[model samples]
Target: MRDPVDKLSAMAIFARVVERGSFSAVAREMQISQPTISKVVKALETELGGKLIARSTRQLSLTDEGLRYYAECRQILAAVDAAEHSFQSGKERIAGHLRIGSSVSFGRLQIAPRLAEFLKRYPDIDIDLQLNDQNQDLIREGLDVTFRIGELNDSGLIARQIGITHRVTVAAPDYLRQHGQPQSPAELSAHNCLQFNLLNSQNLWVFENNNKRHEVRIKGSAQSNNSEAIREMVLGGLGIALSPVWLFSEDLKAGRVTAILSDYVAQSLPIHAVSPANRRQSARVKAFVDYMSQALDAAPELKPVR
Candidate 1:
């Protein structure tokens, strides 16, 4: 009888061939001969009693059965790799590819600077960081972790509140002088409001004063999906902007911009380190969350707008 271990090995080789799109490529990656890869795939197909892949001179594609089988193979392979990793590291030291996602501005200003320190602490871990303004589907994208600003609405994932940031109504010193500062939320309608397109209430500026909250619709000539662009425009005196305090802390400190309506500051947005519930026990994900939690806690720039 054919050994089960040998059968699994052949299936793994077949999966690799499909993943690579060519037997030759799989052979090169696995450091085996092309004939060996082809034989393994053929053997796998025979054992399964179905056509797994369609091969032609110019292209290769997976049949419907092959696609389903490939998905299962990937899961099994991942489990096998995780088992080996557990044996190697004893589940203490993190060692694997960790894919993290974050907002462009926050990732560049905050997370990027601290990555070197994290790498030094865990030399075995490999990181892939993606920064974008759009919210990513962590599980769908196979991400290990993500940094989310503002209130999270996705109920499928588990979120850890790492830190909180306040929203500040700010304007360039020149713009404030030219248009006058908004002393109240009502006055915000008169000023040009530089808007972040990603915010849920992009045109609405919310403020709280004397235990009462108000939302005011704002209009401006300028709007941008990228926060950095909006920041630049605000600095150039294009318009007033309601922004996260951390995004403009240095500018505020340097007097490039000044906060307005201090008495009616907006509610705080809690920053979350979110991950799929199943991956909460992953060592690399947990390590990164812990590190970020501590790092963000110490960052004074993220303090409440005062």
Candidate 2:
């Protein structure tokens, strides 16, 4: 006996729950209580006349029926979004909610600082910035776009290369003083090299010297999934690290860390703005990507090494 409008609202809530994988996340985003979110979804299941979600202590999974309904919900919601957007003028059309994702350090150093200016330009556009060290699935997380670094796998997502992350081999002054500087890429194997574990080739360091490529397998006392953690380890004089120059630009300038093996060039990772292939590119997403592309391109630090 609920109003049709209420049912639509419930459907939207149910879809949000599916996208976020939790009722709490949708509740926070919608500025509602968690119990209210659960109630709406429970009501939805009752109306549908079957169990849609399989709930457990650890995680939520969709039933077969839930999966079908979820697919249909996406199509219906997308159509509604399109219909609403069609009536707006060009500038109005560009205004909406955007969920953006990035790695912890990149989001903190690059994206977070630039958001204020982006917001000022598009006053009506609201953004949710999600930061994590692990790469999140754009479709599963319901993200409009995500900034990624390193070589991408064949994930079937669309990626636009926005910048290059020129890398350098560096170590703290005390560490170099104690362990001696490495003259060549091969010498890296003799030192305690800190590893960034998120990359597939974490222990394998690659370099180029005078058009010759060298790959060195290194071992370390410590390794971390986070770039900032690796930076901290290097700064603590624990070990040498081959990382993006931007990650230690200030430390290098301050002489807290010193660049070594300057004659050998470390492999540079590509910075990409990636989006789900299945999602239609909206004006807001396009605008944010274009803005970030221009912003990141102008940074001399992100430019390819000569």
Candidate 3:
């Protein structure tokens, strides 16, 4: 019989195998032979006295016991990582891979442009920036941090409010000239409104003026899940859009688009740097979030209009 193995190491390997969904993939990641990886997991199962993984030619799956064990393993591993991270000193602690997520337009316009300077400051760090319109599971995607716009729905995340997305109702000059400017919130119904379908209330627009509120349900010729696409539609003179002020700040200055409904206030969304609550925040993640918060605070377009 084989002597007792390092159970913590074996548990980590098992977790990675399940996370990657392939034994070969985990083996390649750890730079170990595939058989050795399999043996480690098998040994872990043997010691635990139950099957952890069911393997086939196509994929790997967890049994009921494995699922529960895997969940506990993740929490324990994260705690270990956090404990180790706490011991490293100063800038030395901030060295590692950071996986970041954000919406396409925000990532492109705000985060991507600032990365060069951030990289220059922390040369030891590497970043993987993933931009998508859909709000996918951050833990499943292995994201260390994500920039979320609007009110957060995921109670499982720990969020820090980094900025405000001050919204505006805007249209291209050509569109306004053709459709006429909407003088009041109620008049928006007479115009073509572009909707960003990702929001729950995409078709419903709310405005406030002098303690009075107006809710308008609008219809349009176009609807897109992406904010960039909505911006494009507004630029093409197809319709008016209610979007973040940063989205069209340059366009507003350049006369490409005009901000209407000045008498009323469009709802502003909060920008948050979110992380999985179960995982402890690493130094790199904290550093990045702090840098982003400071950078965004200085941005004029993200500031709330008084």
TM-score of each: 0.78, 0.90, 0.85
Q: Which pairs clash (backbone N, Cα, C closer than 3 Å) in model 2? A: none
lDDT of 1 by residue, 35-144 (tens): 98888888888888999999899988999999898778767765765665675444545788888999999999999999999999989899999898899867445567
- lDDT tens digits by residue: candidate 2, 179-240: 99999989888999999999999999999888999999999899999999999999999999
lDDT of 3 by residue, 237-287 (tens): 999999999899888889999999988999878899999886778888999
Give me the runs in candidate 3 sitting further than 4 Å from their true place.
1-13, 20-47, 54-61, 79-92, 304-306
Worst 10 residues of 1 by lDDT: 84-93
TM-score, model 2 to reference: 0.90
Task: Give me the candidate number with maximum TM-score.
Answer: 2
The TM-score of predicted model 3 comes to 0.85
Name the regions of candidate 1 deviating beyond 4 angstroms.
1-78, 87-90, 277-281
In candidate 1, the residue pairs with backbone N, CA or C atoms under 3 Å apart (3 or more residues apart, or in different chains) clash, namely none
> lDDT rank, highest first?
2, 3, 1
Give each model's whole-structure lDDT: 0.84, 0.88, 0.87
